[model samples]
Target: MLSAGFIVAVVFSWIYDITPGGIIRTEPLPKQKLPLINKKVKTYRFTTFVSVIIIIGLLSFNIIDSASARKIEKIDKTIAVLPFTDILPIKYESIVFDYIGNQITAGLSKIDDFNVLPWRSTKNFRKGNKDYVKMGDEMDATILVDWKAIEIEGEKRLTIEMIVAEDEKILWSNDYSIKNSWTEISVISTEISRNIARRLRTFLSLEERARINEIPGSPTALYNAYRGRSIAQNALYLYEMGNRKTDLSDFDVAIDLYTQAIQVDSSFAEAYANRAVTRLWGIYTTHYSGNELEKCLEDIEKAKSIDSNLIEADIAMGFYYYYGKRGFDNALKYFQQALEKDPANVDCLFYLSLVHRRKGNWDEVAELSSQALENDPASALFYINIGTSYDYLHDFEKAIECHNLAIAILPEWPA
Candidate 1:
């Protein structure tokens, strides 16, 4: 209506005169002045058209954005937990500082209704002055969970907040004084997970509640497992960064930590499973010479005997077939099982992509790689996998595009 009225006013001003005398049709200007008047009118019209176009473009963008936001709201159950910020003195910033957030994230991932983004996808936001809502949108997460640890008057304190991604509103928040023992921290993580779930109005099943409440066999074992897992996670990141030849040291350290955990608690299935994974990758990176495949299989069997539904065990078994035996068929089966339990698991998606690549199923390879990339967008390895699939499929244009993206993300990587 505003646009139409503006146009009508412009036309009326050109065609009529509103003077103190009366409303009247304007007579044509003198020939001497007519050119100048016409030029002014033409400029005004061009400006008006441009203004209208700008208005339309702005309106169109808003409409599209609103629609996208609505679509995002429909998936509000999708959540991303960012890494915890440590503001304590440098002396206290150890593996314990990282474990709180990581434990809560693991607990929440057990819930069926909450589609939690993998930690790999959200960890990079730890040090940035990031807008939580924008990060959520980038990761296709409709909610964000963040926490920070700070020391106040010699007392360690932590504050946790859940934010709605659409408006960056704090939907829920709580604070706690940090605990001294690893067991207490584990309990605190479970409490935080439960509190967040309640804030979201979701019902946690009996099994999920058990998972959140289950502390490992002992504080010593749990601490060792936590440290091992942390080291392994970093080692995996370094491996992904194309440091294939020199990254074995971290893996070895991680393996030793896992072994310590296993010694502390013989029934620690997770530690055994993680040790198997580190050993498998260590050998795979060294062209299957660092550790015996049978030792890796023994860990897998030990973990599975203790807990048949262990996802890590399944993953280790999948790699056992892929990297150890080159048994693509068995690799596919184990990976599929793991993916069924955790659809957004980046490792399962990545391994499945590799298996399909070996089977010459380019379409499946691309599909799995794309899913993995969604969970770990900054991962150059996933981009390379997608590029390889495109290359094999004869899509040279897209193949080059994917490789360029990988190179752009990792410019220091060797050609």
Candidate 2:
């Protein structure tokens, strides 16, 4: 029995020795797990994640905003005011019509943002029986101001309507009525001007409105200096319209008109400049050379002596240097100078592009052509220059592309 007990005890000791160490162990170890995260740390982590997200969103928004700004910057806005219609009741009231029309025109002229047609041109518009839409297109007018004055109950009532048309579609229109009063004519004129300006402000900025408001008026001279200036301007317009025979007579008339204007107001810079152009035209179209050219130069110099800031004088000098004398460098210098004075001067830009092309400066030709295009995108001559520039640079495909665009814009050669 004792030997059997000994055997059992020996088996128990072997089982205990072969058992895993943790199962046999009796003492418990101290817990060593990390403490639960505090609310502050969790809040910090969440805030950091949100801040990172916000930063990324802000950066993306800025990038998109900058791209949108660039696109908006490229858009250009232009406006033109059409000729005002004469609204007179009687034949004798034509003089009244002229006075009222002149007043309205003078008021609108104060605003610089708009290209206002001169009263003389507007008056001549009725002579051709031209369609108002076609006239608007020819004059590049975006807005038309139609006005009528009639006797209502033996009292004069002036009705004025403003229309904005593109492709003959009326975009906006408004009517204004005013009673005639000679004593308050200036006040009435100023009111009409302000209303027109306000309507324009819907599309134009304040600065542009101010520009339209600053147009100068005819000086109070017995001879009507502004009227004389208008006659000279019309003569040049005729010359540009290619009526050489008529233009020559008009030039003579312009000379007389400008001389009268200068007599009335010696400080009339425009009269001197236009007279210089008229004199230059005489030398150019009369087949006069040598002494005539010298005479033309003297006349232009006198014009410059009268007003150093005249753009026409610079243009005249440039043309003389380029076409008459073939002095390309001098021509380019004067052309560049004129462009500096008026960046939107199409004549100067066109001449400069031509001179650059002649000088084999293809880059400058392209640059000047681009500037001219900005001023007059409808001009086929500018596109032709662009195409030629590309052709000279061996960019045949681009040359053809530009030529095609030019042809598309102006289908006929003289168009």
Candidate 3:
């Protein structure tokens, strides 16, 4: 109330004068015209004028600040890729569709013009008849990549469209027919990237253009590598899809897919790491014993040997130490290392929080879980972790608030 009265008094004094004899007078302020300055004679008028001008300037600055924020929001270089609709008779052709989607996303990620949403982030939208606009809004993206694929005889037909999320307008569309070979997928991806980049009119440097046309060493090597890469990608797609089932069957299908990936690419470190992660899950369920455990450890070690800097390998090590060896400190160390490599990684932050939770470090748990939500806000697990941390800290109100947020994101889950 005191602050409010002070403000009101200041505002009233801006256009009036007060005398020492307790009289309020409506006296016009005298101005002395001195060269480039019309200086006010009264101290109150000078101060009030300066205050009013400052207030007006602040209001103008706020208006511009709001407008600039809106402009920045509309100028986001973000896009979401919906899983390509497969209209083939073969049910298993879903893998091909997924692989094609992956290739296009990977190709576009190479361009500096836009950011492609991760597959994990978009896969959950495969429920019901998804509204493109809602998905785009949820992802905070301006563009949506809606695509479809059809396999006819020995050729594949692909159709892709870019929709402006705000107005549901088609920004660009293309239809292409090519040989149903693995190499052809990359060809389609590059052509689509080039066409979309041109439509966006983003200034592409010479080097970026050159990347769009990069070729393999030789035709023979290109054929094998592309084919192997697609096979591995499709297998990974299967693994990811199956892993969402929330049952032991997830391990079954994901392991088979990883095996297929290894068969196609003998030196695939990522495939090894993914397989080892599933194996770790199996161990947690008491499904792997003796020789099987040894094999899983070998796979984890082999993945680290192949790629010393693989984040997935680091995550696998973290999990191995936590679940298999019961070494919480070592697990936390590796998880922290992985988080350092990719601070925005959802799994890294969540798993690191899990370790903190185990150690009864409620502060650390809350911090890590909150950080995970920064990258993947839709993750109900992270919210749950935060709620659990609050619960441990005896903050029931905050715990309830965090749980409410989790419930809002995943209403069906009774966490």
lDDT value, residue 131 of candidate 1: 84
Compare the candidates by lDDT and give the number of the best one.
1
Evaluation by lDDT, superior candidate among 2 and 3 = 3
Scored by CA lDDT, what does every candidate get?
0.77, 0.60, 0.69
Ten-residue stretch with the least lDDT total in model 2: 215-224
Model 3 weakest 10-residue run by lDDT: 216-225
Top candidate (TM-score): 1
On TM-score, the stronger of 1 and 2 is: 1
Tens-place lDDT per residue, model 3, 343-399, is: 767788888888988988878877776677666545555566667777887878877
Model 2 C-alpha lDDT per residue in residues 1-415, reported as the tens digit of each score: 4334545654565455444554352333346655667999999989976875676667667777666656433322233444345444554434445655666666675555556655543543442676556766765666666666665665656666665534454433444444544223334555676776554543445765564444222333212434444455455444444566664565566567667766766665556555555565555555234454565576567768877877877887886777567799998998889889977667787888789889988888777766765565444455666677778878777678667766654465332
| Model 2 regions more than 4 Å off | 1-77, 83-160, 164-195, 201-250, 293-306, 377-415
Per-model TM against the reference: 0.71, 0.49, 0.64
